[model samples]
Target: MGENKNIILALVLSGIILFGYQYFIAGPRIEAQRQYEALQAEQAAIEGTENAGVIEQDDAPSLPLAVSVDPQTDQSSSGNYTYADAKTIAINNAELSGSISLGGARFDNLFLANHNVELNGEEKVQLLVPANEDNGYFVRFGWTAVDASISADDLPKATTIWTSSDTELTPQSPVLLRWTNAAGIEFLIKIELDEQFMFTVTQTVNNTSGNPIQVRPYGFIDRKQEPVTDGLFVLHEGPIGVFDDNLEEQTYEDLRDADGGKFESTTSVGGWMGITDKYWMTVLIPDQAKQLAVSNLSYKASGGYRASYLEKAASVPAGGSFETQTQLYAGAKIVETIDNYQDEFGIKLFDRSIDWGWLYFLTKPFFAGIHFLFGLTGNFGVAILLFTVVVKLVLFPLANKSYVSMSHMKDAQPKMKALQERYKDDRQKLQQEMMAFYKKEKINPLAGCLPILIQMPIFFALYKVLYVTIEMRHQPFFGWIQDLSVADPVTPLNLFGLIPFDPPAVIAIGIWPILMGVTMWLQQKLNPQTNMDPTQQKIMAFLPIIFTFIMARFSAGLVIYWTWNNLLSITQQWYIMRKESARRAAKAANKA
Candidate 1:
């Protein structure tokens, strides 16, 4: 009985220690860090240390010499959709540089694409376009064409270095573009116009100067501008390309976001603009360049989200030309669109952009892999099941060792109980004897708790994965659990014969928690506890019920994983117990 009191004391003390550490030490430290960051942001905004609205593309205005018959009309040969063959591709917003216009509005899209065109030899270059409330000026809502055109000969000689296209602005969907050579070279452009905007290349090459131009190219996104606000996070796509040096984000000085604000994901097919996806610009250039430049996405007038400019250099080998293409997305971060999109210009969601300790990095790959495997079956629940099996397999040895120890203690229970009765008055001596026995047998008293300790972090990590991962937001798990992120459904106060059903999450029709508790209870019953205090045994038995309450609110994916884990443990423990019992029986018979 006193031994049970000691057990209760330990549990209570642990609870108090946890509470104090949470409220007094760790809480204050995190709060202080947040407060400091907030202060710095406010101070920067107030002091005007940086220009809040300097769109990168417009830093240096383009010298677009205008020439036109009617500025108001669309310069198209096919009724309204096709544009005329003009050497100068007119951009609506003249300030388009490396920034984007979809900064903080309901619709936010920053487009950046890199393309490679084989010239005489393989040459690479980069193009950049950022769209933020502070920087992107490429999305001109209503405006006349700002002339952006240049000739093939205007470019310098090819340098043959790898590059990335910094600019490719489309209205909403990508404009279909093709390269044609009449005089020197011509580009047939097809743009899809929504009621919201217009797009054009700020400049085009006047081919009368030359011909057959072998162009080599790549793409880039110029995000060298300050963020719209200090508090906003910077989400970016991981560096993707064939070049080793260019794939590293650390090398770029101007584009770095210390806050780890850059988040990245890929596009789905068919150009569906849901609430959670973004877009990128596509670029194509000639073999090389004596000089090359790019800018952000932003609007030229009223400081909005659109911009257009021209970059011209490189002397083409008469009859040589280059062309690039991509779409501009000015929209929100929709989970459905991003998670399943294959069209891919790597879009990073908000949570991935946050700094959430080691968990952020560790769980990212795990989440992605699980999603990929289970995503194929269209059942995230099954995917989680497979995921659980893998985790248990990895930790199988640890569990096996623990089960073996438990079986041994079960066999020794008779001796342990005798000792307890013998040392009933001497609690300290009883504990010392038990410890000595355990030490001699090389068994750890804490073996039973080790699995829990190891599982807790993985469990927490899984929680984070389900909560923030857009992929699981609306995913279904069997019939009752429609959305894994929500809570379970149960009874409510009846208002009428209308008979209102409980919400899905509250519905006990879900069997995951019940199964989890049962497996846990069975595992506990199977494990051996020798000379255990009665109260300690009860607490151990009741633990599964407490766990059920906590786990019921978690995502179905998480509950499913735990359920599988527990069930496997039950089978393994039962098998180990049977084997150990048979061994003792054989030994007793032989001795007798």
Candidate 2:
């Protein structure tokens, strides 16, 4: 009896640990995020009306070691200019639409045309914003002085307006901008784009100043303020890059602490660095053959985070010219597109931009299989269902053996109970007798847990895939499930949205979660209950309800998969239980 009780206790504890995290940790975080988003929206509306036409200055916060800074001043500088004063040049492409500011020749305003700001919304998703705004996030390129021959004034400043040869930038038609310094030195930038999100920028310097000048060319992505994050530890949502063949990921908090200081990797040969959001990325890709230093820093005065790189300085002789070509990737992180760039451009580990977690070996293949299924069906929800069926089929032999062993244990329950009662006072002897009886009946009690143990890692891997992949974001399933990446939108307390009243998160159970609970309850019925204590049986019976509450805020795709898996398990267990009962009855009749 004690031995059997220990097994029951172990199972109960496992279930509790799995569901406990949702209640004690994830539940409050979701509620806080909801409130924080609402507050941000309200603040943005107020700021738009109050701060209109005001020129917001850039933040030049202090840091420990600066990657690239103005040589004229020790402190960072923000230009005194308004959005109205700056001229904008449009970039219209099939996949991207935005404008470039002529003032700094910065690729600061960008939007993903295909991705919407919200599910089923008309407005497109914005990737880059104006430099004057509070949350000014953009990319900038310029030269850092390497020798005394070049002064800060000789380099193009953020306020320097360049003359563009073309009115607009397109995939086929590129734009060229040129500026000249006091000493007759000319700097020209030619920007080119592809059909997709890749941007090829070639910077050329013409030194006609009669004196050779030494300078280093560099580019950086800066965000004025920290953006909202989902706060899940498994997914990184800040600075990400591959330096010298090593992948480095730093969260927003980590960058904030590095303010007025420098956090950088040693000089590496062949890597790319950039800032990453949940679904989008803005990174600078240096030439793989060139040696460069990748660094991230936080500015204390401006409260901005930056990721930048500096290539080796070159000395341009008088009347000599130097030019180099680099690439910039700013768009949705679609796995296929990134992989294509990695193969064609020779960008080292570019696809590692996606957070593949520790189980990339397994998670990557799982995502690929599901993506293939989604391509055929055109519905992520349906693909998840089909994927569950395929997984169950693959594990059928192992599940079958587990269920058969469980059935044999159920058949020996009467003898086991008799032994328990006979040696009730001696706990050791009772355990010994139980083991002997299990061996005599050729039943391995531990075999029943094998399938469950195998499935746990698979479940976690699938969760990471759904959580980190952009392809799953804003995807629709059947009715009432528009975004499979988020929790089910329809809540039972609100009568599935007909009431128009938002319920608390604790009562936000959805229809799919209820169905999952029903299937779990049915599966439990098929399992042996004869040896369980009354209290343990009651606890086991309540597990389905507890899980239903725990999974209320999970992604709808995961809920659908769980419900389908439970139904399959119930069907298999029922068939095995019935078969064993009939065999026992037939043997009894033959003995009579």
Best lDDT among the predictions, by candidate number: 2
Model 2 Cα lDDT, one tens digit per residue, 220-299: 77887777776666688888888768898887777656644445764777688888988999988888888874444444
Backbone Cα, N, C clashes tallied per candidate: 125, 8
Q: In model 1, how large is the Cα lDDT of residue 258?
A: 25
Best-fitting candidate, measured by TM-score? 2
Using all chains and alpha carbons, the TM-scores for the candidates as numbered come to 0.46, 0.88
Q: State how far residue 209 of model 1 sits from its true place (Å).
A: 28
Q: What is the lDDT of residue 573 in candidate 2?
A: 75
| Tens-digit lDDT string for candidate 1 (1-592) | 2343465456545545544554466456656767776787687788883444332222222322232232221122222111111111222222221222221110123222221222122432222332323332222211122222433222211110112222343344433333333343543333343322222222222245443343222122223222222111122322211111111122122224323222121211111111111122222111122222221222223232212222233334455543433333322223343343222333333232222225766566567757877767878888877777777888888877776676666666677778879999999999999888777767666666666667767766665666555456556777667766554433232321136654433233246777777888887677664555677677776777766655665557777777888887777677767777888899889999
lDDT of 1: 0.42
The total number of steric clashes, by the backbone 3 Å criterion, in model 1 comes to 125
